[model samples]
Target: MREAPPNAVAAHYATCTALAFSAVAVPFLPEAVLLYAGIQYLRGFLYGSRQWRAPARVPLTLGRRGYRDATTRKRGEATWPVGTADGRQVWLLRQDLAQGCAFQGDDPDWQAASIERLVFAACLNRMGAVVVQDHAAPPLAGRIAAVARPFGCDLGMAAIDLHASLTPPLHLTTSAIEAALGDLGLSEKAQELNRALSPVLRMIGTRHGLNALALYRAFLDAEALSTLSRGEYEIDGLTVNTDGPASADAAALVDLQALGEAEREEARQELAPYARELACTTGLSLTDGLDLGTAIAARRLTCIRPASPLTAVLVQALCCEALAAQEPVSGSEVLVHLGELHALSADTVRRFLTSTTAAGAIGTVALPSTPDATLMRLVSESCRIRFEHRSTGKQWHTHLISTLKDCTFSRDIEPFLVERSGKTGNI
Candidate 1:
C-alpha cells in the first residue's frame, strides 16, 4: 500500500483518539486534548493535506488617532496584543471587562485586576478557550493550536487549575483576586503577573476615568510648590485685641510694645515722598497729607497682623496710597519705603517689587541708573486686592489696609482736616 502523506497520517491518528475517548467517555482527557481532536478532524475535512500555517503577526500601534491592528480589518472596541513567555502571540479582545471595572491607574486597585485578567486569559486558553479572537474559528484555530502546543506547558491545565482553585468565581475584582492569591501562597506570582499585565493594559483602550484623578493630583502639587516658593511657610498673623487689660505676664507686654514700635518705624521712616504726593493729589496741603499719611501708615504697620511679611509691606503701602487720594506713588518711592521697612537684601527686594508690579499689585517707573544699579518706585495708590474664601463663603481683602481698619484711619484723618466737626483744627 502507498504510504499516506504526513498530514493525513497525523489527522487519522487524531481522529481515532477522539473516537476512542467518545466511546469510552474518558474523564481524564483534557479539554485542549478534545479540542485538538476536533481541530484535526476539521483540518482533514476542509484543507486536506495542506501544511499548517503560522498565524499572521499583527503590529499594534497606539497613538492620538487611536488603536490600529496591522493584519486584520476587524477592530475591537478595545484590543491588546500580548506575547507569551514561550514566544507565542495572543491578542486580547475587549468586552464588558471594563463596564464595571474601575478605570485603570485611577483606581488604586486596577493593577491587581490587570494581573488577574492576565492569569485568567492564560488559564482559559489552556481549557480550550481561544483567548485570541482572530484565531477562534475553524481553519485558523487548528493551525494556531498546533503551533501553541509544544511550548504551551505554562498555558497547560495544571496551571489553570491552580488559579481556579484560588478563586471560584468566573468574574473577579482586584481585591478578590489579591485575597485569593495571598490565601493560596501564590503571592510570589504577583510581580511576574504585573510585569506581564502592564503592557497589555496599555495596549487595551480608553483611560476616560483616570484623567480626573491625574488632574487633581497635578493641581495640588503645583499649588503647594507655588506656596513654598513664595515663602508662605507660616500661619497669617490674625487681628488680636489688646484693649481689655494689660497681660498678666509683664514680659509679654514689653515684647508686644517692642514689636509694635519696630513696625511703627517701618511705616514712618523714608516715606515722605509717598506721603507728600498723596497729600497733593487729595486736595490737602502737602504738610497735612504727609503728616496724616505717615501716622496712618505707622498705625497700620504697627497694629495689623498680616498673613505674610509681603502682606505687611503691602498694607503699609496701601495706607500711604489712601492718604495720597487720586495721586499714584512713584515706583522709586515704594522701593525706598519697602527697602527701609524690610531687612532683605537689595536683590530680594527688587525681585519682590518686580513680581508685584507684574501682578498689578503695585505700579512702577523706569530709573536712569545702569541696569544693575537701576531701580523702580511704586507710583499708584488706592490699589485693592480681592480673594474668595473657599470654605467660609466670605469675600476677603488683602489691601495695604483692610476696610475694617477704615474707622481707625478716619479718626486719624479728622485731626488733619482743615475743618473738623464744624470747628477749625490745628491744621
Candidate 2:
C-alpha cells in the first residue's frame, strides 16, 4: 500500500490528539469540546483539502428546553450546515436555516439553488433578512452576498440601521457654509456676504419652501437689478450699457410697481414681450425669456439647488460604474472617473468617503490576492449620511436625495447675450 504523505500523517495525529482531549474534557468542560469542534470545522471549511459545500442536513430537537441538534432522531427540521464537501460540519442554526431539504441527489438546478441558498443564508445570518431582501438578484444580490461572506457582514450596518430610522435634513453651520463656499472658489468678501445673508435666506426658505439654489438665484437677481439700476455695469471684460434699449425695456418694468394691483396685472401681460427681449439680451446668465424683475413678478423663475457633496445619487453612480466594470477598479481610478463625470475634485471625493457625515452609506474592501498592489470595492446601497455634534454626542442623519438631471451643471457658465451685427439683440 502507498504510504501517506508527511503532511497527511501530521494532520492525522493532530486530529487524533484533539479527539482524545475532547473525550476527556467533555464531562467537566463541554464548552471546550464544542469550541474545539467549531474551530476544527471552520479550519476544514476554509483551508482543508476538501471543498466547502452547503445545504447539508442534521436532525433538530424542540423539547422543553429549546431548539438544538438532535443526536438520534432520523427525521427532523431541515438544517443547513457550513461544512466541508466531504461532510465535516462547522456551524448550524435552527431559527435561520434555509427553506429547502438537503441535497438528495445530483441535479443542475438543485446544485445552483443550493449555492444560492448558501449565499443567501450566509448573508441573512450576517446582515439580517432585510439587507438580503433589499438587493435585487443576478448581480447585486450575488455581489453583496460575496462581499458579506468573507467579512461575515458589513460591520457598518448597525450605525447605518440606526441612522436610517431618524434621518434629518442637512443644516450647515456658519463655519461649514464658509468652508463649502471657499471650496466653490468664492472670495473672502463674497463668503462673508453669503454668511451675513444666510439667516435671512434660511427664513425665506422656510416661508417660501425655497431651497439653497432658489435662494442663490434670488440673490443673483437682486444683484443684477442693482447693477441695472446704475444704468451701466461691467461684467468680465464687457461694459453693459443698461441705458441702451435693453435698459429702457427693463426700466419700464419698474413703472409697473407703482400702479394699482389690478392695473399692474394688466400692464404686466402687455409688457412681458419687451421684458422677454431685454432678458434675452441683457441678462448675465441664460434666462427663460423673462428679465429678473419680471420673472419675480410672474413667479416664473425656477432654480434647483446643486446636490450636496455626498449625495446618494453621486455615490450610487460611482458604485454602479465600478461594479459594472468587467475588471476590478482601483481607488485612484474611481476618484478620477467621478471627477471627470461630476466635476468633483479628488479631495472632495475622498472627504465624502471618509466623512463620518456619510454615516455608513459606502464602505471599501481591500483585495487580498493583489499583494503587490491594492484594489478596493464599495459594499453597500444605503442612502443616508450622518452628522454628529462633537460636544453633545447628539446625532443627525441626512437621507441622500436623488438629483435631477436638468438641475445638474456639467459645464461652465455661458453668456446669455451674444452680439449679432454691430448691436446685441433687443438692444
Candidate 3:
C-alpha cells in the first residue's frame, strides 16, 4: 500500500488528539458547550475552515420589555420568528433561520441583505427541485442540494426538505419577487436587483434538462456575464469591452473544447492515486469525484483576450489542428501547413507563435533547439472564441443581451451599459 502524504498524516493525528481532549474534558465542562464545540470541529474538518467561522452577531431585543415581548411568528414555512425591537419588527425568513441568526432590524442595509438572501434561496430551491425531478434521485437530491446551499449555511436534510415543501412553491416571476420585497419595504430597489439577477433567472427557467452540475455552472456563468454587461469588466482576470472599437493589440481565440478535455484529463490524473481511499471514505464514484474536483479547479483557471489578431488566428488554427491530430504538432510542421493554407511567411508565423505562447494562448513542452519540437494548445473553457476584429465586441454584447432577455426580473441591463459607456478604461 502507498504511504499517506505528510500533511494528511498530520491532519489525522491532530483530529485524533482533539477528539481525545474533548472526551477527557467532557466530565468537567458543560455538556451543551462540549457538544457545540465538537459539532463545530467536525463541521470544519468535513466542509472547510472558512465555512466553520461564525458570522457577526446582531443583537435582537424587544423594546423596553427586552426578550419578554419577543414572540415567534410564522409566515408560510419560515422556521424563525419576526422579533419586535425598539417598536420596529425584524423579519426573519427560513433562509435566515438556516444560518442560525437574523438581521437586527429593518434598516435599509439589513432589508437589502434580507432581500438578496431571499431571492438567492428561492432560486437555489427551485434549481434543486429541477435537479431532483430531472435526475430522478429524490433521496440523494436533498443531501446534494443542502451541500450546494450558499452563504456557508450547511443545513441538515430536514431544512432542505422543509424548503421543498413550501406552499405555492418559489417562483422566479418579477411580480412575485417584487411583492415579496414589498413586504419588507424594499420595492424601490426591485428594478436595480432585476438587472443584477435577470440573466441567472432566465437561464434557469428557459433551459431544459440541465443536470445539477450544469445548472450550477449556468448560474455561475450567467452571474459572471451579467456583471460584465453591467460594466463591471473583471471576471477571473478576463476583460470585458463590449462597446469599444477593436484595439491594435492582437486577439487570441481560445479553443474551449480542447481546454475542457485537457482539464478533465488533468483532474483524472490528479485523483487517480487516492481513488481507493476516496471511495472507502466517501462512497463516491470516480465520475462523481471528477465532477466535484473539476468544479473546484475550474475556478482557478484564468482566460484573457489576446492582444494581436494574427496571434489569435494562429493560435486558434493551431489548436484546431492539434485537436484533429490527437497529439502535439511541431512548430515547423504547423508553419508549413498554415503557410500553404493561408499563404503566410515562415518568419511571420514563427514570430506570431512566440508571441502567442508568451501570452499563454498555447503551451510548449520545451524550448525547441530545432524546429521539430511539439507545440501544445491550451486555454480556459469559459473563454469566448471570436477571431474577427469587427465582430468581437458585438459578439460579446449580443451574447450578454441574449442571456438577459426573457428573464422574469428586468428586461435588460441597459442602465449599467449606459453608465459604463461614459467611462474610458481598460479591463
Question: Could you give the C-alpha RMSD of every candidate to the true structure, in order shown?
Answer: 36.9, 23.4, 30.6
Q: What is the lDDT of residue 157 in candidate 3?
A: 17
- Candidate 1 residue lDDT tens string, 206-228: 23222221222221233432332
The local distance difference test score of each candidate is 0.27, 0.30, 0.26
Q: Give every collision pair in model 2.
A: 357-386
Model 2 alpha-carbon miss at residue 272, Å: 24
* TM value for model 2: 0.26
227-295 per-residue lDDT for model 2 (tens digits):
433444344456556467445433533432334444433433433332343223221111122121221
For model 3, the run of ten residues with the poorest summed lDDT: 410-419
User: What digit string (tens of lDDT, one per residue) describes model 3 on residues 127-208?
Assistant: 1111111111123332333333442222321111112323121112233223323322333333333323333333333433
Q: Give the runs in model 1 whose Cα sits over 4 Å from its true position.
A: 1-78, 99-427
Candidate 3: clashing pairs of residues:
249-307, 249-308, 250-307, 250-308, 250-309, 251-308, 251-309
lDDT of 1 at 359: 27
Query: What is the alpha-carbon lDDT of model 1 when measured against the actual structure?
Result: 0.27
